[model samples]
Target: MFFTLPLSAATISAIGGSTWSNTPPALGPSWDGNPPGTAVDILSGQVDEYLLSGGVPGMFSFSAGTYNVTLLTEVAGYAGSNQLGWAPLSNLATFNPIFDGPDSPIMKQTIAPLEGWAFVINTGGGDVFSSSSIDRFLAMRSAGSTNGWSVGVEDLRSPTDYDFNDQIISVEAVPEPTTSLLMGTALIGLALLRKRYTKR
Candidate 1:
């Protein structure tokens, strides 16, 4: 089965000193808990809910198959005053042993265990798909990273706001029909064998 996750995120603080989304607004809070210890389910694709936080990377398990991921939306601001226009977070995060077949121009890299790497957001949406320009290489404990986002996604900001919604990603794993058919055939054979034994 394929997984689908729809979420939003923001990184980087305003040029001037300010705080935006510091507190979960009336609209709602993305990161359920406190900073630096955000939940990892945001990318699990197991839930069909809107994810609004990203700090601690999740340990997502997947089988061998092409996964189609997309950036739903992205926004940045400070106290809702110096808010930047919300736009489609057109960023692409390609992992090693994987390729952005659709966005060929986009860049992809392999993440080592204990490595600290995160998905970067390109507000301009220019080759956000491409990793031409990237920041620090981080890792996740889930993937054997030396550490995880302890401060949360605050590092994305100059002062480090815990919004952690700069870039929301949804990954859908392609279905394998051949594998399903083989399993079905095996089950049928087992059932027939059981019936024969019962007759004896």
Candidate 2:
């Protein structure tokens, strides 16, 4: 005879596409697309790299558009003290804080027309790590959307577990009808060009 017990949320390391500690905290509104426990590829053994939107690692930007950011969860030792912010490309000195600990669990913010930007996570005690530095975060696409992403953070450096569940957030770039039409036209043009070239 064999005995098996079902797993509780506390026994899992990830849930709803975010990582968790032994005793997971309450998460925010569900962001559809990437389901929980899906395997998202990040650089092996590198927690500070981001490869989203076909952009350079550690930095990302969408075409002119407004985007929504949602705070998903915070499971770090400093969950009540850490902060999340954004800065212009390569400009850590001007990082602006948008979300902080002890705020609403489902807090949301809107950013407009970003071209060049990097995300940073600020842990207390003067520890601030930027995406550009390749030292404290991971960013990946949100399942199938072209402009949606999920970012996870480790928050600490001393005993970096690389679980990336310490802090998690979702970014979604709102699509414009005009932009969609233009993209369709451009894609058609490229297809025509490719067809002509192939015929030759």
Candidate 3:
């Protein structure tokens, strides 16, 4: 799937300084409690509902697909304000990874685990801008023993006022129909052989 999440004013203030100004309003709080930890789910319909209910500025979109995301990179910029900036928090891993403001541009030199979560941080501000929100959009896919991909986002800013107009894209590989057919054939042959052996 594909999703676009715009940063909120509160998120900006949290990352950027209050003096940064040009902060957008806050978007309504709508997130699914999934992906474990603090990762929140910000689906499209939910965002629309929040907007209709008088939510804040900034918008995002998500699409569903069967692919594996081994790498994740954040666009360079502050979600709410220009003063602060968004940075990577940790290297991607199978377990829950935390991205704090202290670790900006958290880059992973190796390939990420087959399954897990990664977090980002907003830094460069103090006090009122200290908190952060968990804005997330997730996509999951799996077939038998193989694990696909799951992605999430955490705003890390307070409520009250913020913007959430950011974009996230996942790149992965999809199994071809031929590969699926071959696997299916192999399974069928194995089942037939087992049945014959049992009869014998």
Order of candidate numbers by TM-score, starting with the best: 2, 1, 3
Q: Candidate 3 on 1-200: residue-level lDDT in tens?
A: 12222211111111212121122224333332122112113333222112111122212211222333333333324433322222222321122223322233322222232322223333344311112222332222222212223233334344411223222323343433445556777888899899999999
Work out the TM-score per prediction: 0.28, 0.55, 0.25
Shift of residue 17 alpha carbon in model 2, Å: 24
Model 3 residue runs over 4 Å out of place are: 1-113, 118-161, 170-184, 187-200
Report the number of clashing residue pairs per model.
15, 1, 41
Model 2: pairs clashing at backbone N, Cα or C within 3 Å:
17-36
What is every candidate's alpha-carbon RMSD to the true fold?
14.4, 16.2, 15.1
Q: Decide which is better by TM-score, 1 or 3.
A: 1
Model 1 lDDT per residue over 167-187, tens place: 333433333345556677788
Candidate 2, residue 61: the lDDT equals 33
**What shift in Å separates residue 109 of candidate 1 from its native position after superposition?**
16
Q: Please, what is the whole-model Cα lDDT of each candidate in the order they appear?
A: 0.29, 0.52, 0.29
Please report the candidate that would top TM-score against the real structure. 2
lDDT of 2 at 184: 75
Worst 10 residues of 1 by lDDT: 7-16
